[model samples]
Target chain A: MTAQPDQRITISVDAMGGDKGPATVISGMAKSAEKNPELGYILHGPEDELREMIARRRGGQMLLDRISFRDARDVVTMEDKPSHVVRHGKGTSMWSTLESVRLGEAHGAVSCGNTGALMALSMMRLRKLPGVTRPAIAILWPSRNPQGFNVMLDVGADVRADATDLLQFALMGASYARNGLDLPRPRIGLLNVGTEEHKGRSELKKAHEMIESFADRANFEFVGFVEGGDIPGNRTDVIITDGFTGNVAIKTGEGTASLIGDLLREAFRYSPLSRIASVLALTSLKRLQKRIDPRRVNGGVFLGLNGTVVKSHGGADDTGVSAAIKLAFQLAKSDFSEKLAARVASTVELAQDEVHFASATQEKQEGS
Target chain B: MTAQPDQRITISVDAMGGDKGPATVISGMAKSAEKNPELGYILHGPEDELREMIARRRGGQMLLDRISFRDARDVVTMEDKPSHVVRHGKGTSMWSTLESVRLGEAHGAVSCGNTGALMALSMMRLRKLPGVTRPAIAILWPSRNPQGFNVMLDVGADVRADATDLLQFALMGASYARNGLDLPRPRIGLLNVGTEEHKGRSELKKAHEMIESFADRANFEFVGFVEGGDIPGNRTDVIITDGFTGNVAIKTGEGTASLIGDLLREAFRYSPLSRIASVLALTSLKRLQKRIDPRRVNGGVFLGLNGTVVKSHGGADDTGVSAAIKLAFQLAKSDFSEKLAARVASTVELAQDEVHFASATQEKQEGS
Candidate 1:
C-alpha cells in the first residue's frame, strides 16, 4: 500500500470556500503541484465548475491528471455559524474535504472557509483524540529565534481555557514545534503580563506549576513566564496561552506590521529624493518583506484532533493558499496528527497525576 | 486660589523613581519648562541631589526659580511588590509625589516607577472616585485616526474586568478621548476576537449591549465589536477591554514594531547601495519615525481616581519623560480630573438604571 514511488501525497482542499472562489484555489493547487512534484489534491466543490476552471488553465491536463474531484453541492459562506454548519453542512465542500481525511482518502485537509465552521466540522468529523479536552489552533510567528519562527497555540479555537487546558496546549505546542519546526525539545513559555512570578491570573500561576512539574517528563524546557514582548523574542521557541489572548496578540502584531508597512510606503513616496532612494533600496526592502511575509507562514494547524486540518486566511489569494497547501503537505508527509496523538496519550497519566497532586497539596495547605 | 499672572501650572514629579535617575527627570522638567514658560514643578527626591543636579544645568537659575523640592529619604525599587510598597513606602519619592496632588499643592502627579506600586499607592493615596470600583490605565496608540492616536484603557491596571467594569472603562475611556484627543464624539468599540455579535466571551457580549445602550447618553458612537486589528485602525477612537487583554495587545504591538524597526535598520545596512539610499531617504524615514514615535505618546493616565496620575515608562529617557510631562501639563491645565469626575457622576444613575434593567430583562427571559 505504501510502495508507489510516482503516487503523490494527497491534500483535501475545500475549493469553494475562499474569497476568490474556486479559480484561486485551483491556481494555488497548480502552483503547489509545480513546486512540489510529490503533492496531489482531492478537490471538493461542484464537480462541473471546478473541472471547467482547471481545464481552462495552461497546465490544465497535468493538474487534472493529479487531481480528483468530489462533487459537493453546497458551499459554506463566511457568515455561516459553527452550530448551523455542524447541523446542516454535510453537502458542503468544507464537510466533504474533512470527510476525505476522516475516511483516510487524503492525508490532511485544507480550508479557507469560516474559521468557526471549519473548526466545528473538523471536531465533529475527526473527533478529539483520547484525553484531549479542547483542540487548539497553532500558528507560526516570525521571531528572533534561530529557527526564524516561534509556534503559538490556541490562536482562536475557543474564547476560554482553564489551567488544565493551558497545560495541554503546552504539550501539544511543543509537539508541533518538534514535528513542524524540527526542534527536538522546544522551549515553552506561558504568556503573562509580566515575567515576574507574582504577576498574572491565578489560573496562570496554577498552569505555571503544572507545566514546570511536567517539563522534564515531557522532554521540553519550560521557561517560567514570558511577557507579550517575548513572543517575538529569542527567549523561547513556543508560546502557550489561552485562545482569547493568543488570538488578540497575533492580530495586534499583524495590525502593527501592516501600519508600519503603510508608513514605509508613504515614507518612500514623500519626495522626489526619497522616491529615487526607493529604487536603490528595492532589493533590501524586498529582503525584509520576504523575512516577515505573512503568506509564507499562512496556515493555522488545528491540533489535538484525530486528523490534521490547516485553516488558511479567508481572504487569502493564490499565493497565500499555496503556502497553506504546502504546510498541509509537510504535516501529512510527517504524519503529524498521529505523532501528536501519541504524544498526548503518553502524557495523560502524568497530567492526571499532577492535577491530583496539586489538589491534594491545596487541601493540605487549607487543612493546616 | 486663582493663579497669578506670573504663576504657572505646577506638576508633582517623582524625581527618584525612573531607571534613568533624578537627573533625567530634572532634565525632562527643564526641557518642558523651557518650551512652556507658564509651567512649574514640585520635584520630589533628596533635597541635596536635586539642588546639585538643577544647579549643574546651563539655565540652572531659571530652572531653580521655577522648581521647589520635597525631601524623601526612600526610593521604590522596580522589584518592590505593590503590597510591600503600600505598607512601607511612606518615605519614598513616589509617595511624596502623590501627596502633593492629594494636598492640592499640584495640579497632577507623574511617576516613572513600577506600575503596580504606583497604581497601589495611587489608589491608597488619591483614592478611587465615588462610583468607581476599579481604576483603569489608559494609553494612546498610534493610529490612522485624525487625532493620530486611539485611546485604549485598562491596559494593565488590574488583570480582570467584568461586564460592569468594562462599562465603566468605556465611560472613562471616552472621557479621556474627549479631553486627550479633542474628539467631541469619540467612536468606541469593544475589543473581541471578531466583530460578530455572537463572538467572544459572555462578558464581552454583555459589555457590548451595555455600551450600545449607553452610547447616545454617553455622547459616543458605539461601533459595536472590533477585532484586535482595529486597535490601530481609524474605525474606532477608543478600544475598551479588560486589563489582561489590553496589556498583552499593547505589548505585542510594541514588540512587532521593534522587530520591524530592527529589520528596517538591517535592510538599510545590507549593501553599499542600500546605505547610500538610506542617506537619501533619511528625512523620509525620520518623518515616519516621528509619526509613530513611542516617546511622543509616553504616558498612561490612571483614570477613575480622585486626582490625575500619569505613569511614564520605567525605562523612559529625557525625551520620553518630557512627553509624559507635557501630557501631565495639558491634563492639569484643562482640569481633566475634575471634568472626568463630573462626567462619571452624571452617568452613575444611568449606569445603575441600565444594570437594573438588564437583570430584569434576563429574569423575564429565563422565566419565559
Candidate 2:
C-alpha cells in the first residue's frame, strides 16, 4: 500500500461516475490529455464501455495510447451512503480508482462521485499520514486576493476538528497554497466570529496559539483570526477552519455566486433593448463568466492522506471534469502529498519544542 | 432594569455612533420618523452636538419635534474592547441607548458602534431572559425565500452554543422571524455540515432532537439540518447556528456578493461597446442593485435579551441607518421582546418535560 512519490506519474480517473455517466468523463479526460502532453490515465470502469465512449469523444488518437484500463464491476450511485459504500464497495469504480493511488499505480485519483463515499473510501484505503489526526478537504475559492483564489480546507472531510486538528489543517492548507497556488509564504488566517483575540470557541483560541507557535518554522505568516468576509478578499491566502465551518462556507459561496449568476442573466434579457445590450456585451460577459466560473476551479484536493485525491463536483460537465483532471495532473507532477505529510510532521515537532521551551523558561523563573 | 412590554414604544438612538458621527444617525431617524407618524425617538449622545447635527440635517419640523434628547458625554469607539466597555461604559451613548430600553423609555435601541461592545453592553445591562444561557445577534440576509430574506441568528452574539443553547437559538430565531420577518410560522433549520441525520457535530444532532420535540408547541416547522447554501435559498425561513458559524457564514455571503458585484461592474465597463450596453441596461442594473442592497436590510437584532437592540453597521450611511431604525420600529410595535422572553421560557419548559419523561422511562425500566 506504499509507493514512492516518483512512481505516481499516471492520474487515475473514475470513468463511470458523475451525472453525465462515462461520456462526459471520457470527454473531459480527452480534453485534459490534449492539453497536458505527458498526462496519462488509468481509466476505471468496465473496459469495453469506456473504450467505446473515449473513441466517440476522441480529440486525438495519439492521446488514446496514453490511457490504460482498469475494469471495475460497480459504480457508486449518488443515493449510496458512505457507510454502505465502506461495507459493500469492493468492486465499485470509486474503490478501485483510489486503490490505484494506494497501490502506486497512479500518483493521484480524480473522481466525480458521492463526496461522502469518496471521502470514506479514500480514508479507509489511503489511511492518514504520520502525525495527522484527520485528513482535510481543501478547495480553491475565487477571491480578490493577489493569487486570484484562497485555499480553504476541511470542507467536508469530517464534521468536527479539535484544536490539534485545526493546527494540522493550517499547516496542510499552507503547504497546499505553496504547491497549489504557488504562494511561497502564504498568510494563514483562522476563521472566527470576530477578528478579536478573545472571540470564537476555545478550540480556536488553542488552535491560534498552536498555529502561531509553529508559524515561523512552517514558513507561513499567521495573520491571526479573520472573519468570513476575508475569504473572498486579499486578507489571507489560506483560511483554516474545522470541516463543518469550511463545508458551510464553500457551499454558501457557491450558492451566492450561482444566485447572482442567474439574476444577472435574467437582468440582461429583461427586455428586447436589454437583449440587444447583452449581445453587444457578450464578449465581456464571457470574460466575466470565465473569471468566476466554478468549473474553472472545479477540484477539491484531499490533503493529509498518504496519497492525493481530487474530487470534482458531482454535477460537473466536460469543462468542469477537465478542470478537475488538470488539478489532479498538477498535484501528480509534484511530490505534493509527501510534502504535505512532511509539513504536518514538522509542525507537530515544532509545537512540542515550544511547549518544552516554555516549561524550561518557567523553571528558570522559579530558580531565580 | 425590568420593564413591561406595554411601556416599550419609543426607539432609542445612539447619535454619536457610526463612521459618519451624528450626521447620518440623525438623518436616518428623520427618515424613519417621517414614514411612521407614531414613531418617536429618545436620542442618546452629547446634547449640543446632536442638536447641532439635527439642525443641519433636519428633514421636517414635525420630525424634529418628535425627537427627544438624552444628554450623554461618552461615545464608544470601534477600537474599544467589549470587556473594557462593560467596565467603563456608564456614560457612553451606546450604553445609554440600551439603558433606555432597559428603563422602558424605549422598546428597542439602535446603535452603529462596535458589535462586540454593543453586544456585551446589551448582555450586561438588559440581561439574559429566564432560561436563556446566551443572547444571539440575528440579521436579515438577502434570500430567494418567499419573504425575500431569511433570519439567521447567533451571527456574533457569542462564539459558542451548546445543544440547549442552539435549541434556544431555534426558538428565539423562530420568534424573531415571526415578528421581524413577519412570517407567521417560519420553518427553522439547524445549520450543519450536511443535511443527513448522521452528519455534523454531536451538539447539532442533540439540538435537532431538542428542537424537533417542541416544533408543534412552538408552532414552527422544523426543517432539520440545513447547509450554508440554504441561507439564501427558499428551503427554510430561519437558519440557526452557533454565533461563530453564523458570523462566518454571513460575512462569507457578504464577501461573495461584494466580489460578484465588483466583477459585474468590471464586466459592464470592459469595453466601449459594453459601456454602451451598460447605458442601455442601466435601469435593469439599478433594479438588481436595489434587490441586493445591504443598506435596505441593515441591522443585526440582538436576541435572547430582556430588551431588543438593533446594531447598525459601523460604516452605514443614512439609508442603512434608516433601515436599522425601521426594523427597531417594527419589532417595538409587536411587543417582540416580551414574546421572545415567553418563547424561551416555554421552550425551556418543554425541554424539562422531555428530560423528566426520559428519566421516568428509565425508572420504570429499572423497576421492571
lDDT by residue (tens digit), candidate 2, B1-368: 23344453588999976998888887888878778777789999888877776776635556668888889999899888889999999999998898888888887899999999998888889898989988889999888886889999888788788998888888889999998878888999999877888888888889999899879999999999999889988899999998878888988999999998898789887888889878887877777788889999999999888888999998999899999999988887788888888888887787789789999999999999
Model 2 vs. true fold: TM? 0.93
Interface C-alpha RMSD after superposing true interface residues, each candidate, one decimal: 0.7, 1.2
| TM agreement with the true structure for every prediction | 0.96, 0.93
* Highest TM-score against the true fold, candidate: 1
Q: Write the per-residue lDDT of candidate 1 for residues B67-119, one digit (tens) a residue.
A: 88899989999999999999999999999999999998998889999999999
Worst 10 residues of 1 chain B by lDDT: B1-10
In candidate 1, what fraction of native interface contacts survive?
0.74
Chain B TM, per prediction: 0.95, 0.94
Name the 10 consecutive residues with the lowest summed lDDT in model 2 chain A: A1-10
In candidate 1, stretches whose alpha carbon ends up further than 4 angstroms from where it belongs are: A1-7, A352-368, B1-7, B352-368
